[model samples]
Target: MASKVIQALYNDDDVLMHAVKKVRAEHHHIEEVYTPFPVHGLDKAMGLADTRIAITSFLYGCLGLTVAVVMMNYIMIEDWPQDIGGKPSFSYLENMPAFVPIMFELTVFFAAHLMVITFYLRSRMWPFKKAENPDKRTTDDHFLMEIGLHDNENELADLLWETGAVEVKVTEKES
Candidate 1:
């Protein structure tokens, strides 16, 4: 069956946030939202689950720290020991101060890069992927909310219009 949805466009994020709250309060099902910029608290308003990106970042940081420690230990102590500033490279713990900068840099680097990659993958935003937004204006200055149609399109549209939507549209979409 061809699914139907209502698209509500708002000129301001504040209006969109309010509309989301109103829609949720009335027990409407919102499919998705598109915005030109990040809207704070929109996820909470939409009742979305908390994100786990921070946990992934911490894991990536741990992996990076482990790599740095193993690589430094092998290179400085096991492979080719160096003598610098009257310090012998005998133990990683003994020369921990000198490796602090490297450890910190690698940890940050891995966390940042891996987090970006994970986000892109999770969002299905890989390279060369086609855009999925219904309106081009949503990428510029408009905020769009998509709500499922459940035999009450008119009522939903009216409510959306009352919520300060600049434009409201009902369209059939393939399930």
Candidate 2:
């Protein structure tokens, strides 16, 4: 038997939540959810775990800071030291404030760029990636509930309609 995808569209958040609750109560498997804007508490309702990107971002920021400091110190002090304005430039530890701007910039730069790249990679998003969504209307103005079905397609469709779905459609794989 092949797996099938059934999508239920809803215009109201409360209706969507109610449908999700009903679907879960019936022990049906929900594959994924798509929304145009953030829905508060929807993740909890969908039983999704919290994202740990914040921790990753912090670690990446620290790495950036370390790189900036080490590179700057090596270039200005060890590799090619230059006496500027008659001041000793052998050790930057005494005047770390001079490097604060660069450090901050690098930290922010790394955190933002790396975090975005990580997020995109983790989410399976890349350049030239074709769309995986089943319904294009869901992206514009509707909430979608993607449910996997093993059998009993008509029964599931009726349940979804009774649960206040505006429309229901079935999506089959290409192969």
Candidate 3:
């Protein structure tokens, strides 16, 4: 049989934080927290490590810039060089400003597409992927804290209620 997990639902992040602080002070184990929008300093309170998405985004942007420069250089200078209005084609280095538009366009294109793809993959939000939200209201106006109870489940629920939980429910793990 799967063990049950208790979730305390709150309307405000402040209330949630108070509850987390209280529970942690009492050495209760917290499983996860869900919020509709990011609550500043909540991750620190929960002792979560910093996310690496910023570094990943920077790397992806650099890749896009490199691809743009290489592709533009290859096409305009090597593959099929063309001159317009008596402008030199063999030596684009002298007219580097002319390639700026193409470079910017390609950089934006690649960075946008790749960043979106990366975010989706990292969040496990592929096309047609069903979100595992336990309550529909959680996506709108509710903040939820999921705690695991090794013992004293009833007392914990009472504490959560005292700390401003709008509702408390126990959910059994799916087998």
Candidate 4:
């Protein structure tokens, strides 16, 4: 069976937020939303699950810290010890001050870079990928909300219009 969606266009973020609340209150299923800027509390309004990506970032940082510790210990204490500033690189604990900067830098680098890669993969935002934006205006100044249509075209369109949608249109969705 073919699917359908109702696209609602709003000029302002406030109106879009209001419309989302109204649609959700009426038990309508919203499929997606596009906004030029992030709308505060939109996810909560949409009833979306809280993201779990922060846990991955913490793990990535731990991996980087572990790598830095092992690498520094091997290079300075075991592989080739150096004597500089009257302090020999003979013990990791004794020369801990010198390794602090490298450890901090590596932890931050791993967290930031790995988090970005994970986000890109999770969102499928690969380089040169075609955008799924329904309208060009949505990328600029307009906000768009796509609601799943379940034999409620007229009812949903009327509700959207009442909620201050500038335009409402129904279209077939590809499986």
Candidate 5:
């Protein structure tokens, strides 16, 4: 369904940031923001909570380390022995020096790859997914803020204009 929204366009990031803060100060809900580049402290200005992706990344790294250890122990120590430098230890701890590089590589690999996947999924982005940007100009040098339209359409537009928005208009958004 289509919903009414107030689209505020700003030519500068600073203006957009101030407009966001003003809109929020008035207790207006911000539906979305489209910016050409990342705005510093925008999440805080939007009153969003801190993300927990770092925790997931740490877990992924741990999993990778476990997989590497198990695979190496079964392969080089139990299944088929490898005598590096003509010395056969037959113990994972003894052969740990040689396994350090593999362990480190796997840990970083899992953390990086899994974090990327998690980010994509969490952001609702995937292969062949359509873009959600409301305006094409947002990809360039403009910032657009979409505020859901309530009974205060004119009030919001006036407030946004006062906050230095270059343009403000009401439009129907696809929900």
Candidate 6:
């Protein structure tokens, strides 16, 4: 089905934030917002749920730690024991101090890389993906708010303008 939507553009993040609040206060549903940079508090203002990336990051870190421990244990204890600085590779527990830095580095590396990959996958963003922003200006300096139409295009446009939108246009979109 085809639906009409209003795209409102704003010059400043502060104005966009206020406009979002005003629009939500009137009980209108917002489709999406595009900004050149991250707008702090915009997620809450848009009523989006909290993200679960932190939990995934912790899981990734644990996986990295496990890999590092198993790898070090096999290489140092069972495969080929080496003596460095008069310290013998007899047991993992006894020589754990030397492995602390490696464990920490692996944990951080896994968490950072995996979290980025997870974010990209969860957001449906990938290499060579087509751009979705309707206005090119939004990628540069402007902020855009899209609201689905319920046959009140004029009212919504006026409200957007009053709430500090620089430009408002109604367009039909296919779902």
TM per candidate comes to: 0.93, 0.87, 0.84, 0.95, 0.95, 0.93
Worst 10 residues of 6 by lDDT: 83-92
lDDT by residue for model 4 over 87-124, one digit each (tens)?
76878898889899999999999999999999999998
Per-residue lDDT, model 3, residue 20, is: 84
**Candidate 1 segments exceeding 4 Å error:** none
Q: For model 1, how does the per-residue alpha-carbon lDDT over 1-175 read when each residue is reduced to its tens digit? A: 8899999999999999999999999999899999999999999999999999999999999999999999999998899999989777888788999999999999999999999999999998998999999999999999999999989988999999999999999998776
In terms of lDDT, which candidate is stronger, 1 or 2?
Answer: 1
In model 3, pairs of residues that clash are none
Model 2, 13-69: lDDT tens digits are: 888898888888888888888776778888888888899999999999999999999
lDDT, candidate 5, equals 0.92
Report every candidate's CA lDDT: 0.94, 0.87, 0.84, 0.92, 0.92, 0.95
TM-score of 1: 0.93
Candidate 4: where are CA atoms >4 Å away? Answer: none
Candidate 5: worst-modelled 10 consecutive residues by lDDT: 82-91
Expressed as tens digits, the lDDT of each residue in 36-66 for candidate 3 is 9998888888877898877777777788778
lDDT of 4 at 47: 90
Best by lDDT: 6
Backbone clash pairs for candidate 4 read none
141-173 in candidate 6: lDDT tens per residue?
Answer: 999999998979888889999999999998887
Superpose all Cα atoms of candidate 4 onto the true structure and report the RMSD in Å to 1 decimal: 1.4
Q: State candidate 5's TM-score.
A: 0.95
Per-residue error for 140 in candidate 4, Å, reads 1.1
lDDT for residue 3 in candidate 5, whole number 0-100: 92
lDDT accuracy of residue 104 in candidate 1: 98
